[model samples]
Target: MKLLKVSGILLLSSSLLFGCATMDKSTSTDKVKETKNTASEALKGVTDEYRKYAIGEIEDFVKATEAFTTAVKNGELVKAKELYGPARMYYERAEPIAEVFGDLDPKIDAREGDVPEAEWTGYHRIEKGLWMENTTKGYEQFAEQLMKDVNLLRAKVETVEVTPDILITGAVDLLNEVSTSKVTGEEDRYSHTDLYDFAANVQGAEKIYHLLNPALKKKDKELSNEIQTRFDEVYRLLNQQKNGNGYKLYTELTEAQVKELSQAVDALAEPLSQIGIVTEAS
Candidate 1:
């Protein structure tokens, strides 16, 4: 009898402990699921907001391209030159979204020699003619094609599926665009309008960060604040180089100024890179 009683007590204790362990495990699993769901919803909201913003930028880009191309086709060299930087600014500010349409991006914005000379057409081709060749003659065909391509981009962006990865990667890519080409003054080599594109790229990345802020803050407020601070610092540095309604031409910038801007962008890029990981972890 004693042995039986002792066996029964041991069995009951084991069952109770097992039940508690199972309950704890189940509770932890539920919490993780809840966290994941929250993160997903937050990211969905960010993407939706970004989609609306991207559509607006492309709409503006289309209008600007219209005016710019019209000037080029009419042989209004001065007007075309004036419009070039501002018009490209719209495209630069929303480049990642524009890039979604693959070949259209290269067709519309490819630099000189980016493609075969036989196949070359778009803004840079016109840019070279305006500044290097010093005439808009012979550019009428390219101007018309450029306008058509930008309009198509506007139409295609309506169907773009904006997501967290797109936003995050795009933000990073914009910074990279600045660091790799715009900062080096190679993008607008003929026109010397690299600063305009550089500023626009930063603005676009900032917009992405703005959209992602709420979600990111939820996961890591400190990081969100740090990124914002860096953005402000970069913009402040850029402002020092501004000239009137536009920025000073890239050629006018001293090497030290370029280096300062490059360093600021690098500083911002480091923290901005962490945003995706934090949001995904949520």
Candidate 2:
């Protein structure tokens, strides 16, 4: 029962307190007005903050992908393999926001079965070359396509709008992604980088939750507390599997460990999903 402490707990606490103080002494009518204003302001701040984070992550993803592709193109298979999982960490963190662009997301991150063989070109495509094939030959075109898609993602993030619903939905979507793919090892199948992606996805979702927490605390402190506790639990489980900043390969995880992680994610997701409903009600 070791606790895995994620960053920003103090900030969330201060935000929740600040939110409470803002509404503490108001009359019913004035409270409603203030609550609306607070929620509006919080939404705008969260949107702006998340956009900045998303853009930065995509830029990093682009750089990492470029380095990875270069290694592949230069016939440095060992370097390419070394860079593979690290490169994908950025994408996993920003995926909820990046996936907003329909065509680009698929092109950048789509798994093999997600698209036709002819159309399956992205990180996973190159992944198979490095891991399954154990060589980077014949993946030049796919590597090039991945770079284009990642750059497109960076550009598109500039124009993307972030609403409260989007933030809430993105948080939930991240968790669902873990439960559906990463936990099951469906993602990063070739390289066993699922742990890195899993951690990134959780981190991404937690970012949104932290941003919205002040407003959420005002609406339902109990629910907010529950969500936070669950997040800590999940992160604790994940932290146990970490090797430095990255995680051990998915193949290293015991069946029981995977089950524990899956259950933790499920527990977090239930309370995480309620964020949208509570926000809309406020």
Candidate 1 backbone collisions, by pair:
none
Worst 10 residues of 2 by lDDT: 1-10
The per-prediction CA RMSD against the true structure, in angstroms, equals 11.7, 7.3
lDDT per residue for candidate 2 within 25-57, as digits (tens), equals 445445555655665676688789988888899
By lDDT, the best candidate is 1
Error of 1 at 205 (Å): 0.7
- Quality of model 1 by C-alpha lDDT: 0.83
Candidate 1 per-residue lDDT over residues 185-220, each given as its tens digit: 999999998888999999999999988787688879
By TM-score, who's the top model here? 1
- For model 2, the local distance difference test gives 0.81
Clashes of 1: 0
For candidate 1, which ten residues in a row score worst on lDDT?
Answer: 1-10
